[model samples]
Target: MRAYHLDAPRLDALRLVDVPQPRPGMGEVLVRLRAASLNYVDLAVATGAFPAALPLIPVADGAGEVMEIGPGVSGLTEGERVIPHFLPDWSAGPLPPLASRRMRGITMPGSLAECAVVPAAGLVPIPSHLSFAEAATLPIAATTAWRAVRTGAVRPGSTVLLLGTGGVSLFALQFAKASGARVIITSSSDAKLDRARALGADETINYAAVPDWDRQVLELTGGAGADLVVETGGAKTFARSLNAAAAEGTVFVIGFLSGGDLEASLFPIILKMLRVIGSNTGSVADLREAVRAIDATGLRPVVDRVHDFADATGAYETLSRGGHFGKIAITLEHGHRAQL
Candidate 1:
């Protein structure tokens, strides 16, 4: 099997090499991966910003066909399409006490290869309406956004403020719109903001031109501000998210895309009675709900770019530079099954 490996604990050390294909062990399934998506965390893993064992295959989001199921695996079958849970052990319940230890690419081997062996219980069927590339984007980015939006309790007439046009923000926009929420999104690029408007964004703020976008958000909402803010920019934007939120609104911190050290005051939070919560990528149940909503609404995940497996490193570079508006995917070749 062809796979990219973090031969050492350095971002520049990612390399492609051929290795023996793995087979499913007891209660495990062997998956022939068709597509995988890149995440910022994948970059952290490669660069050793996130702790990982050496010689690790590194990518958390993937969708593939069940090529083989080992003994004791009953729910899955050969040729069935599936996606592995990003945090396999945190299946359908409250967050596990040891979630960090079970996360893919950190504590476990990930889905950057043509084939991988995962416990069958961790695989969820992909929605039939979604192509492999779209399904591949859901396990991490979309699920986290889903949990964030859900935590905000979005409903009809609620306003959702998104920090950027990245994967999680766009998915949050789609979900918020589907629930009849008013969606306000920000981006540095006017063209990207235009695209976001076409995708149901009620208002788009050019953060580059309007350095204080939180004020614009407040203006757009008639001083009440947004009911929910999907805070992807972390340290750099969390303060602004708080500034843009309604008095009783919630800010769900999903990523540190703009870097992680926060320097913000808690005075506004106390005055407004706000809720500031942190979201790791959600449970398997969250993924199921996201897929169901996508399936029902015919929503499609935006793929900013797709690179062939041979150029997986280039995909990482694109993600690292923050040049993409949506998920960056890597496609593999493995006969007819590879057409994801």
Candidate 2:
């Protein structure tokens, strides 16, 4: 099987190499990966921002068909379309201990390969309306957004504030809208803000133009502030996120695109009685609910571009450049599957 490996903690260390295809262990399933989507974590691992065991496949989100099931795995069958959970050991409830250390594309073998062995329990059925490329974006970004919105209790007449037009923010926009909440999204580029408005954002702010964007959120909400703020920007934007939340509102922190160290005040959280929840993507069960919501709402994930498997490195470059409005994917050619 062909796979991309990072022999060291550097982007240049990532190389394509032919290696033996992995096989399913007991209670696992071997999936012939058809498509994968790039996330910031993928870039971080490649660039040494995130630590990982060197010389392993790297990519967190992927979708494919089950080719074989291992012993003790009974619910799944061959040829079923599936998306592997980023955290294979976390099926439901609270996150398990040491789960973060074993995430796909970070500590273990990821989706940047022709085939991957995933625990059968960690596989969720893809929504009937989505293709492999679309489902590939759900494992991390979509599930995180889903968990954020759910934790915030967004519903009719609620107001949602999303920080940027990244994958998680856009998915939050879609999910919040489908729940009948009004969405206000911010972006550095006006063009991206316009695109977000077309996707059901009730208000859009060019943060580059308005340096005090949190004030804009407050003004848009008639001084009450947003009911939910999905905070993707850390350090630089965390203070503003705290100020932009309604009293008793939730600030769901999911990313650290701007650096993780915080120099922000806690007065807003204390005075407003705000709920600041930190989310690590989500569990396999959460992914299942997210897929169900997508199916129920007929929602589609925003895929910015799809690269051929051979150009997998190019996909990483696109994500690193930071202009993409949504998920960037890689599609594998399964022409040789018959030979397997």
Give every collision pair in model 2: none
Clashing residue pairs in candidate 1, if any?
A: none
| Model 2 lDDT per residue over 4-50, tens place | 98899887888989999888889999999999999998999999998
Error of 2 at 78 (Å): 0.5
TM-score of each: 0.96, 0.97
Tens-digit lDDT string for candidate 1 (104-172):
766777888989898887888998888888889999988988898889999999999998888899999
Residues forming the 10-long window of minimal summed lDDT in candidate 1 = 331-340
Model 1 TM-score relative to the real fold: 0.96
Q: What is the lDDT of candidate 2?
A: 0.91
Worst 10 residues of 2 by lDDT: 331-340
